[model samples]
Every structure is written in structure tokens, then in C-alpha cells.
Target: MLRWLRQLFNTSPLEFDESWRPELVSGFQHWSLLSQAELDRMEMLVTRFMATIDWEAANGFELTEQIKVLIAAQASMLLLGLDLDGYDDVTSVIVHPANVRLRGNRPSGGGTFSSAPIVISGQAHYQGPVLLSWAAARRGARFPEHGHNVVYHEFAHRLDMLDGVTDGTPPLEDAAAMARWTAVCTAAYDEVRAQGSPVLRPYAGTNPAEFFAVATEVFFNQPHELCEHEPALYGELRSFYGQDPAARISRPRRHHQHG
Candidate 1:
């Protein structure tokens, strides 16, 4: 009864404008892969996401509706199969026009930390905002073959931090699932660190948290490659995300000729 009342009283999702669909489709390459039904759901999710989050622009960059929609669409894709609030901890999204350089402490050979300026494309803060480079995000959306998506990578980190832990594992069904996730992720992570994986990038080997984020980028962008190289890891992600991108992607057919 209370749940029903809450549903009735809660603010409805913003009405998504169909006119914007063309712009979104042109901006994001993956949009063509989604079915009509999936596109409808994504529109709703993106509307909700854009309405819920606070947006800001840095480095004198202009924040436009198109930028917000594109980012929201990519971020919402992660939550499509899950039954949770859309990035509850992500209160703000700070976007830069391009790569931002920041001074950070780096570990030296010894136990000392050195301060240096590091360039970053995107960053997800625990219990804070998501920082992104607009250029990188746009490029990533257009080119999935590159196996890099700033929006997916940073949002994946936010998902990893949902359980108050950033150890690469998100909230799961039970202990058994957690164990399996840990085992498979650990093995793949080790492979990336030791001999480099064909599917995952070298940056994924930085840490367990990064592994999860980078793996997510590859999972969504290059599903066929991920499934082929890291079947166990792909299975874990598929089970968790409840989406089969591999099946959705249609491969090109070769023509046979007879003389």
C-alpha cells in the first residue's frame, strides 16, 4: 500500500523529446545497435538521469543539452538492467572541454610520494562528483572500436563504489556470486598485470577497482572481443548486468560466388 502510494506520488520521469533522438543517434554510434524498444527505455532513463543530476562546466566550457543527453545516455546504460536508483551518490557532473591536468602525489621508488601534474580524461569520486572531458567523451561515443568510453569507465567506478567499497566488486546477489566475481576478476586482473590481456587494456591492471572499470568499457564497447578472450570475465559481467551485448551486435556477412 505504501509502495503504491509512493509510486503514485513520486515525481514522474521527464518526457523525452523524440526530436532529440536523431541528434543522439548521430552523436552516439552505439545508438544504432539498440532496438526500438531498447531505445525507448534508454530515452526514459536518460531523461531521468539528466533531471536528477547537477551539471557543471569547467575551463570555460559551455554545457549544452546535447552534451548532457549524450553523457546521461551512456551512464544510464549501466543501470538499464539493474533495479537501483541512478547513481545516488553522484550529485554533480563536472565536464571539461578537454583533458584536465591536475597535480597529484605519485609514489616514487621508495616510500616517498612525489607531486606531479597528471593529465586525466575522467575521474569518479567516491561519494562525490564525476569529472569528465567532453572531447574524450564525444570521441568515445563515436568510436566504440577503440575500446574506450570515458562515461562508461567513470560510471563503472561509481557502481563499484556503491557498496562503500571500491575493490572492483559491486553489490551482488549473495556470497557465492561475490566469490565467483572475485575469483574470475582476480584471475583476469593477474593476466593483465603479468602478460597483458587481449581484451582488457594494460591500465586495468593498475588495481582491482580500475580493472572493473576498464573491463566495463571493453564489455560494452567490444563485446565480441571480450567474449572471445575472457569468457569467464564476460560471463560474470553478463550475469551481473543482465544484458547480452554480444547477441545484440550483428556481424557482417560474407558473400559466396559460384562460377
Candidate 2:
């Protein structure tokens, strides 16, 4: 009916260019970690993301296809296992050449707020466009060791806001799952604030939303460290993300000589 008609008139399905695979592999470290099948699926998702969203460049920055592909790849990684539509509220992606300085109010002590400018790498607004710094996004994609991915961090926020709430919790399966998620996340969040955690960085202690975002970066980037240090938290992330990055990542074994 109408669906069929729309499909008939719509353009052909978007496909990732084979030539771009090399660039993607060289730029994104996590790209090499994915299997062939996962790469295929990722390519499709990236294509859909690129086609659906309106890409914009800020401050006289030119929006290149490579940039679009790289950003879309990272953002699509978050939705690999989820079933919801890809950022339905996000209509545009605004990319800046470098870090953006935003004018806002900051606490100046003595229970006073003062006007100031804050430099940020990325930001995701509810029911609005996502803002990103191209330099930070590219660097984060290349170096997973940093555990600071602007694309993952902002897209994670978008996922958290899917249910009209900015809380750390996203849509869960059932009451039991929700209960477990809340318990594990609450305990971990408290621990992050109280004494700090080795696996999770200090930024996670900022808030529940930030905790989810920062945890996601570690979950995907530093999976081995996260699994070793925070097994429970890692388990929850694995259950929710439906992916075991630690298993996907290939590590060499050291042979010990007999004493």
C-alpha cells in the first residue's frame, strides 16, 4: 500500500563504497576489531545514517564524505544491537572545525552563578541537532586508548533521551532487567562518586547520564580493562549492548618457560 509506494519511489538502498574500507580501517581502530559480517552490517547502518540525517558544517568548515562516513560509523556502532529507530529526533549534525566555546552560566562559589564560556567537544540536545568538534571526533575514533569518544558520548546521550527522560537508564526489556540495571548502575554510580573507579574515569562521576556515556566509551574501547576491573558493570553493559567487545578483540598470549 502506502509503504510499498514509498519504497517504489524512494532512491535505491545506500551502500558503502568498498574503497572507503581502507580509510575507515586506518582511521578507526575499532573498525578492524569487527568481523566481516559485523562490518557489513555496520556499513549498511552507516549508509542509512548518512542518508537520513542532514549534515551541516560550521565556521566555514567543509563537510567531506570521509568525515561523514567516519562520524556515522561511530554513531551507528551504538545502535548495532538496539531495535529502536536511529535517533528519530535528530534531524541535523553540525560539525565544527575544533572545540566549541559556549557561553553559559557557571557556579562562581558562595552559591552564586556567573556568566562564562565553556569549551566542549560535543553536545546532544533533546529533539534537536547534535553538535560535534571534528578534531575531537576524529582523534577519539583513531585512539581508543583515550576513552573519550565525542561521537559515542553524544550519541549515548541521544539513546538515553529516547524515552523522554535524560536519566542514565534507557529502555529495558522487563521489570527484572530494569531492577537489575538500576541496582548495578546505582551502586556503580555511587562508587564512582565516593572513591572513584580504576576502569571508569572521573567524568563518569559527573552525573548519571555522564556515567552511562563514559561507561559506554570504556565498554567499547577498553573492554579488557573494564571486564577485568568491573565485571558486574561490564556484564550489565554486555547484556544491554548485546555485544562482547572483550571477546571480539584479539589479544596475543604470552608463553611462559618452564622453571
Candidate 3:
């Protein structure tokens, strides 16, 4: 079905519905932070993402336009500075009513795996679908200051997987940039694993893959805090993502004061 849809969409592109603007405004906190040009691009990306991906609802959950728009908007935020091809590995999006539970062997640090039942808000697979919880997605989109966005986290994993490796380092522009990213991220990862980070949560220490995702959340959601705590790490992310969310987030406030 997805392949067929993709083929069909190839013939004619999906149109962005102007009506979804309200959903974007209400469902996503970052909506207001975007410049006019960025908002236009975001709408285009959101329409492409929603139309191309095969969406599914689990646990008898009913999917709605609001939910889809909310999720797509957040996912598109990551690509606001990059090309849409960053998420090419993501073929589908499966949304559950709440956290997903599965009993299996999972990563538990120390290069070891633990066989236990774990519940997660979201999961990203290699060359596969992205699974998310609608409840968590809604909360994250509406409350980005919490610095945890499942859509950002999972889609970030997809971005990291674009280079065919999920070692936390996404495709860099050159060897020089790659070396810098390695140095900065490695130092931060070591700190998180040993002493811990105030901006990054404990889960980031689980692995480099997770460290990237959690850092992505902080980079966008809590840009100022992350920038203040880890300037080099934040610089690496800003350079890689081609976005300075701290400035975008602060521009509005500076305007309101004079207005």
C-alpha cells in the first residue's frame, strides 16, 4: 500500500492544506518561533512527510488530522534547515495510544543487553518504521520546554542512520567537520557517562546513538540551556543542523519588548 501510494504521489505532489495552520499553531509550540520564510518551508515539508509516509494506529487508536499534523510538524522541524532527504530511511510512522510495551532483550549500557519488559514513548528502527506514542507526541509538541520530543528524538535517529550507521555522528560536510564532531561529542558523551550533564538527561549516557537523540531534543527545545551548559557541543549541533534555534526562539521576545 505504501509503495503504491509513493508511486501515486510521484505523479502528483500532495497539497498543503491551509486549514492545518490552526493545528500547527495550537499543537506545536515552536510554530510561532519560525520566520515567515521558515514557516513556508515547514508547511511544504509537513505536507510531503504526511503524504509520503504510511501512517498506522496501534492499540485501537484512532488517528486524526490534528495528530498527524502535530507529529509531521515536529518531524519537519528537524529538517527545517536540511533537505527533506534526511528522513528517507523512514518509510512509515506507527502511532500508539500510549507508551509501547514489549518484553525482549534491550540495551542496558556496558555493551550488554537485558531481557526485560520495557515501555518506551518512541522507537526508531534501521531502514524501518518509526513508532511513537500519540500521548507523548502531543505532550512533547505542546511542551517543548520540557526538552524531550519523541518525534525529534526518533527522527534524529533516522537522520543519524542516513550514513548507514547510528553511532550518533550524522553525515558531516567534510573530514575536518567530522573530526570536530567526534571530538566534541565524544567529550560530552564521556562527561554524561561519568559525571553527568545538567542539560542532557541520564538516558543520553546509554549510548552514543541515544546521546545524539537526547542532544537533538535539547538543541531544539532548550537551546539556550544547552548552549549555556555545553557551548562546543551546541556549536557542533548548530553547525550540523544548520539552525540556531536559540536565536529563532529569542527573536520574538526581543520584538515584543519594543512592540
**Which candidate leads in lDDT?**
3
Cα lDDT over the full model 1: 0.85
Regions more than 4 Å wrong, model 3: 7-11, 107-111, 251-259
Point out where model 1 deviates above 4 Å.
1-10, 104-112, 252-259
- Cα misplacement distance, residue 212 of candidate 3 (Å): 0.5
CA lDDT, every model vs. true structure: 0.85, 0.84, 0.87
lDDT of 2 by residue, 164-215 (tens): 9988998889999999999999999999899988778888988899999999
Higher-TM-score candidate of 1 and 3: 3
Tens digits of per-residue lDDT, candidate 3, 55-134, equal: 89998899998899999999999998885533655778999999988888887767889998989999999999999999
Give me the displacement of residue 20 in model 3, in angstroms: 0.9
User: Candidate 3: deviation at residue 86, Å?
Assistant: 5.9
Q: Where's the lowest-lDDT run of ten residues in candidate 3?
A: 250-259
Candidate order (lDDT): 3, 1, 2
Predicted structure with the largest TM-score when compared to the true one: 3
Number of clashing pairs, model 2? 0
Better of 1 and 3 by lDDT: 3
Superior candidate under TM-score, 1 versus 2: 1
- lDDT score for residue 72 of model 1: 88
